[model samples]
Target: NAGVTQTPKFRILKIGQSMTLQCTQDMNHNYMYWYRQDPGMGLKLIYYSVGAGITDKGEVPNGYNVSRSTTEDFPLRLELAAPSQTSVYFCASSWRATNEKLFFGSGTQLSVL
Candidate 1:
């Protein structure tokens, strides 16, 4: 089974362009999250979903949005991309709480100019 998948592994965006980073998991996990990892920095949450139809903003939600419509998919949308938004985006899943270890996708490297 595909544990977790992310599309367009790499992307470069103009100052104000928009893009969506896709994520999917076959584990039927109840919790999913979108996080950004800057060079030498720990991951920072952008958005998260506890289950299908439930979503919430997290630490760095400024330029990102998310939706959870199925047990297997959660996507992150970036609007008006900016240089500050350039970072490695990771989609992760866990069957339980944040205290548990997470299963993460390889990551999408984003660059904004």
Candidate 2:
């Protein structure tokens, strides 16, 4: 089982361009989240899904969208890439919320030019 896998490990987007960062986990976790980590800052939640049909906005959901149509996938969409959005994007999952440990992907390094 591939715990968590993200594609296009690195990307460079021009201003206003759009892209989708793919995320998938094989652990069958019910709690999935997308977070961005900026230099010297802690992880900021972008979007999260409690389950397959429930999604919610998080701390930094301004330029992102998410969908959880299955137990293993939770992809994040960037409608208009901006330089300010440049950061490391991580996809994480947990079997349960309370006191559960999260499993994180290596992350996608995105640069907006």
Candidate 3:
């Protein structure tokens, strides 16, 4: 089974363009997260969902949004993308929040000009 999958491995956008990064997992995990890593920095949580229909803002949520409509799918949306948002976005999933290892997707590299 596919642990986690992210579509559009790479994308380039104009200053104001918008796009969605799709994430899906086959492990039936209840906890999923979105993280962004800028150049020369560690991953920063952007959003997360504990379960279907339950989502919360993370450390850096501005200009980004997410929805969890099913246990296997969590999609992140970028509205009015900006150059500052250029980064490598990762989607991870785990069985539970505590003491569980996360399974991560390859990542989606986004660039805005």
Off by over 4 Å in 3: none
What lDDT does each candidate get?
0.94, 0.94, 0.94
Candidate 1 deviation (Cα RMSD): 0.8
Best by lDDT: 3
Q: Is candidate 1 or candidate 3 better by lDDT?
A: 3
Candidate 2 RMSD to the correct structure:
0.8
Q: Which tens-of-lDDT digit does each residue in 1-113 have in candidate 1?
A: 68999998999999999999999999989999999999999999999999999999999999788889898999999999899999999999999787788999999999999
Number of clashes recorded per candidate: 0, 0, 0
lDDT of 2 by residue, 1-113 (tens): 68999987999999999999999999989999999999999999999989998999998899899999999999999998999999999999999792599999999999999
- Per-residue lDDT of 101 in model 3: 98
Clashing pairs in 1: none
